[model samples]
Target: MSIRLGNSCVNCQKYEDHFCQLHETTVGTKHTCDSFDMRAAIKDDNNCTTCSRYMSATCPNPKKAAPHMLCNHWAPQEVA
Candidate 1:
């Protein structure tokens, strides 16, 4: 998790709901910019370690996933 996280707000410490706490502006869950800082408390499925597939069973892909890895299959949970 040392590397920059996928340049995403959902994984940023500055993200507060739909707002960017750092920029003081609205943001999408997938929105990102130069200021993205990974959240320390992040345990969302965005990463392989927290992914349901990795937790419940082995990953189906040919390559193994790293802790901070993001894959094409990642789908954000719907906000309802």
Candidate 2:
């Protein structure tokens, strides 16, 4: 399976063990099937400002961003 860094599956709700939960089968990370539903990343009250992928006010993976600008790969930055 070809897995990419910014694949849609990284944040998909149905993504489990590189498998598609809805399809009940394994799927390639690079694959975007018809059932593809973008998953929203968990956000804090501060929102994108605290996201790991938020760098210099730009998102490395724009496709992962929801209409509201929330990203699926938005992980909270670890406290230094």
- The candidate maximizing TM-score is 1
Quote model 1's TM-score.
0.46
Give one digit per residue, the lDDT tens place, for model 2 in 1-80: 85334545645677877788898877765666666666665233444666666654557675554433655555657621
Q: Once superposed on the true structure, which residue ranges of model 2 sit more than 4 Å away at CA?
A: 1-7, 42-80
- For each candidate in turn, give its C-alpha RMSD to the true structure in angstroms: 7.8, 9.8
Cα-based lDDT for every prediction: 0.66, 0.59
Q: What is the TM-score of each candidate against the true structure?
A: 0.46, 0.40
Candidate 2 collision pairs: none
lDDT of 1 by residue, 18-80 (tens): 899888999886699987787675544477665556544446652666778877654333321
Q: Candidate 1 — which residues are off by over 4 angstroms?
A: 1-5, 44-80
Best by lDDT: 1
